[model samples]
Target: MADIQALRGVRFNRRVAGPVGPLLAPPYDVAAEFTDGGEFGIRNIEASDLGAGSGNHALAARRYQAWLKNDVIRADPKPAIYIHRHRFLLQGVPVERTGIIARVRLADWSERVVLPHERTTTGPREERLHRLRAVEANLSPLYLLFRDPTGEIRDLMAAVDANPELDDHDQMGGAHRLTAASHVTIHDRLASLVAERTLFVADGHHRYEAALIHRDECRNTRTADRDSPSEFVLALLAAVEDPGVIVRPTHRLVTGGAANTPDAIMRMLRRWFDLRPADVTTLAVDTDLVGRVVLPRRLGTWDIFAQRGRPHLELLPLDRGPAWLSLGVTAIEGAVNRVFSADSEEVAQHLFPVVEEANAVRDVEAGRAAAAFLLPAPTLDRLLAVAEEGDLLPPKSTWFDPKAPAGLVISDLRL
Candidate 1:
């Protein structure tokens, strides 16, 4: 069963930090920019210091201690789950995504209580483990998506949203409102709603695995009267039915087009996709073409942008590839993996992931990268089906937006 418990969250005090927005760091994995110290800057989180929130784990802990000493952050006197609401605009439409930040007990992926959508690399997991060992805190919460068929949990979150304890407005025009749902009755209801069902890890694959590693290491080395907080990781769980749940695409930018011309790449790509020229001088003119289009419309169709050409709309035969390979993300990854290498692998060597298509296009058009493969965000149905089948799409497959903010509510592992 899924145990989504409340915890003594360590958070920055508004009185000391001025605004939570400035203090908030984008989830360690998806940080776009680092603010040093200004009207827009963060204080001591050292976001850029470590790629994934803790570059120097000891230094990170020291920063935490210093902040605590200076009254910048204080631990909640009582245990509570944070009801969170993020309001954002995507594709020129307003949306409000609601979720809860709570301490979810570590459940192995094999247990089916908690699930992982994508596979993870080893190096990132190792780095996260080192950081967790040095600083006994969760810098950010993992993003999890669960099914609430009857809307009970969604209603509970809505009731709590009426009176938020903290309202943080970020520079991106998104508002993050947090409320502590500590009442015993409400907590029990939420626990019941989220219990015994599979909750998918939308993000934070590395952190979750790192937590498992820490728990295993602790179980062997430590002695404690009660279960340790290391047994759980900070997580924000959103209902699959929530209106605010938006998944954005992570466009892939490949390097070295100069050496391997677009014609050459396209030639290799034709083995899998039926490539045809797409008419558009600019990527922005028909943003939806790239933003809305999903491949295998009839066959293997994907709009692609590469060096010095109009671009191509690709289609693959429905009967040609495996049924699982029909997924747009999977097909694209497979094509890239096949097309861009000598051994028909090593896509990572040529690939750079991007959150924005403009940036992806700029990098390609400006000669910064060999080509850019823009993608549409995978549908909720696609993600669930893939996870249910116990298959991973690819690394950097989904960019769940707005990326969960860090430092909004820190989970103290000691608790």
Candidate 2:
């Protein structure tokens, strides 16, 4: 069963911090531009105070403690589950997503209570573990998805939205509002609603692994109690059925390999795929067909291909599982592997994932990459089904838009 609890959240003090917008930041992994501010806008938690660099962990710890001591941030007196509403525009359309922010007990992968659909690398896991030990806090909440068909969870959130504790906008012009539900009865009800459902890790695979490692380390040192803060990780839980739960495709950019040449790629893919000519203008207007097109740099043309037939599945690489075969990324990986005699890791090294089609094209046109493989976005149902079947997808498969930002609510382990 899933174990969720309310947390005494720590947030920035408006009087001392001046404005919440400047202090807020994107997730650590995607905050490269924010982290390069030197010492000017360096106050953003994701940049210098969080896990941005290897040698900055100790410095981040000192700055965090100083902030708390000087009233730059304050912790709530009562424990509560926070409700966060993130509002943003997608292709000029307004979209809003709501989730519950709470502390969830960490469980091993074998336990099957908490499930992850994407694979993680060791470098990121080790980096996050060091940051956790130094900061002694969950600087950001992990994004999680759950099933809520009865609309009971949505009803509960509506009541909490009547009043908001913190309202602000991010650097991207997205609106954010946070509210706390401190009543013990409300917390118990929220926990009960999700007790039977398995929690899926929509984001934060690395941080989740780091939390497990931190918990074990504390136990070995005899410094952890049954209810130690290390036992739980901060997370934002949302229903998979929510309309605002959008997933975007991540296109691949190929560079410096046998598969980089247009003629070579076409010849290899023709063995299993039927190729057709496609115009770049048609692809630009219709995203549905974008996944099927491949653009080679300096070729000034694009080709769309479809699998010839449901060929023998046994002959293909079935190690990942049958569910993975339905994804566009899986097909691209299979083609690259068969053509170049490479494995998944080797293929990953030569291909880069990009969220926007324009960006992918720009890289190829600018000579930064040799070719681009545009992919289709996966639906929420397809992603959830993949997770439930105990299968894994390639890294950076789905890009969740309007990512939940850090510094909104900090989970201080010392509390």
Candidate 3:
């Protein structure tokens, strides 16, 4: 059974802090990109003591204590599950993703209570572990997907959404709301709903692994307390059937050498896969390519994009060289790996992954990256299937939309 429960969350004092939309930031990894000229940036906490040669994790712990002392943040009076809602636009279409934030008992992968879709790198995992050791707090919530065909959780969240405690709009004009559900009756219903369900880590795989590491370390050093809060990690549980949940493509930008010239790269791409020039006259005007020719997993059809002087190439996927790579994104990665010596350190340096298609093309035009190989976004079903089969995907294959903002509901490890 999946053990999910509420906990006392530390939050910013709204009276002293004013609006929290500016205060609530995305996770540390993606927080840097969204930093504005604000005094309450979490980057301030994560990077303040880095230059003095002090370890970041220790500094993070100190910062947390300092913030608590200064009334920058305070813990809730009672334990409760937080209802989080994000309303934003995707390709001009409005989307709202609602989830319940709570602490889940950490379980081993062998136990299969919490699962992962992508293979995580050791460097990130270790870094997260170090931070966990020093701070002993969950600064951000990991996004998890659970099977909920009957919308049991959704209906419950809807009732709470009617009257949220905090409702504010972020700088990007995205709506964010937070509400508490402290009643045991509702809590028990939710716990029972997920008692037999498995959670798939949608993002923050490294942090989840670090939680396990910390749990194990605590076990070896001291007597194991099965009921201790240290055995849990913060997570935002969203249903797999949420229509707003969609996977976006992160296109790869290859710069320098042959990639600098479309002709040079075209010569290499043609050797293994059939390339046909395609005309894309609808990129700028069409905000959402709902009716465009850009379709993924459609056999023998993938678009290769370049600047004005370069020839546009499309893949003839009729022959994928016996690889059962059904998705266009997977096929592109396969061809790029086979045709280009991506294994070499020299080639890897020039490669950059970007989420925006317009930005990818702009980088190539402005001479930042030599060329960009554009690929369509894969369906959520396709991504889950790959994970279920025990197969791994290439780096930057998927990017979930409107990253769940951090700093809203913090899980205090000391609790």
Candidate 4:
């Protein structure tokens, strides 16, 4: 069972603050040009004290202090879970995603209530820990997916959306986008409905991981037995069926070597599996398939990628490899591991996988990575299957779109 509770959120005083855009920021891990001078630039969140060192850590600490002291950000009057709605378009298709922003009980992996899909890297965890120490607040919301069997949660979400107490509007990429937040206390009658579901994390694996570390640190530092608010980490819960959420593929960018042509890539790939030449001219791959990602090495022609793992993609369905080992992403990772003789350190430095197809190809062509491996997006079903099997998908395998913006309803750690 999931524990969902509304707490007073920290927010900026809109009247005192110039504009929400200056305070609103993308999630900490999101890739955006910070140096760029624009409203959506990374400076918004930089106002938060990130930490006391150089690089992102120091920058984030100093900014956090500035925001707090300048009254750029403030805490809400009471505890509450915010019902958040993001209206956006993908490929010109309009979608409205809804979820509740709240503080969930901090549970270890053993509890099996809050689940994570990807593995977290140590570097990000350390960076997050630094930020947590500096701000003592949840800088972002974890994306959680829930299975609402009774449809009770859906009804509650609908009721909340209809009569939201706070409606925040922003000019997200030109068009006006609206985000509505309401107190969970105002809708306290639905607590039972919120607690009945299990949440699968769609994003913020590092945040959840950071919570575990923070909780441990608190337990060790207590001079006396006391109930500290850090017991619960902040999160945003959306029933899986929420319309505003969309899962998009985070295209892979290969690093470390040369920009190989389609034929060269095929020749190299043939050592492991059979080859299928996709007519790059007409059979352009759809980049948005949730789990079944495609790798298109644009060597004057686009090559369609099909990994030999999934039920649909496993054309041969060989009986040789371990069942879990046969996932397409895993296969690709294995191949890269062998080809580059990649160690963990090198993997972090040069051979990074990106989530955009064009960016991946460009990076390789521009001599950043040796080759780009584009993948199909994993379906939500596949993610759940992997978790139930006590396994994790390859890192950066899935990209949850319409990620919740930070600073809408900040969680106060001291409370």
Top model number, TM-score: 2
Task: State the lDDT of candidate 1 residue by residue for 334-393, as single tens digits.
Answer: 556556443323666676678877777666666676566766566787688777767665
Q: Distance from true position, residue 131, model 3, in Å? A: 2.1
lDDT of 4 by residue, 1-415 (tens): 6776777777766665655544455577653433332432334453333333355555565666676677766777666656676666777887777677877878788798887777778877777787777668786777888877677877776666666555555445312223344454455655666666667888888878988898889889964233466877877777776666677656555544543333444454655554455444222344322122233445333343443443333332244234334345666655445455565345445446676677766665675655566665555666766666667756666788767677667786876
Clashes of each: 5, 0, 2, 37
Better of 1 and 4 by lDDT: 1
Clashing residue pairs in candidate 1 are 50-55, 300-315, 300-316, 301-314, 301-315
Ranking according to TM-score, highest score first: 2, 1, 3, 4
Q: Which stretches of candidate 3 lie over 4 Å from their true place?
A: 46-54, 256-264, 281-324, 340-350
Using lDDT as the measure, the top candidate is 2
Estimate the overall C-alpha local distance difference test score of candidate 3.
Answer: 0.69
lDDT of each: 0.70, 0.77, 0.69, 0.61
- Which 10 consecutive positions of candidate 1 have the poorest summed lDDT? 292-301
Error of 1 at 87 (Å): 1.7
- Writing each residue's lDDT as its tens digit, candidate 2 over 221-330 gives 86788789989999999888887787888888877775557666666656656556665543433322325545554454555445445442332566655566677677
TM-score of 3: 0.83
**Candidate 3 lDDT trough over 10 residues, lowest sum:** 287-296
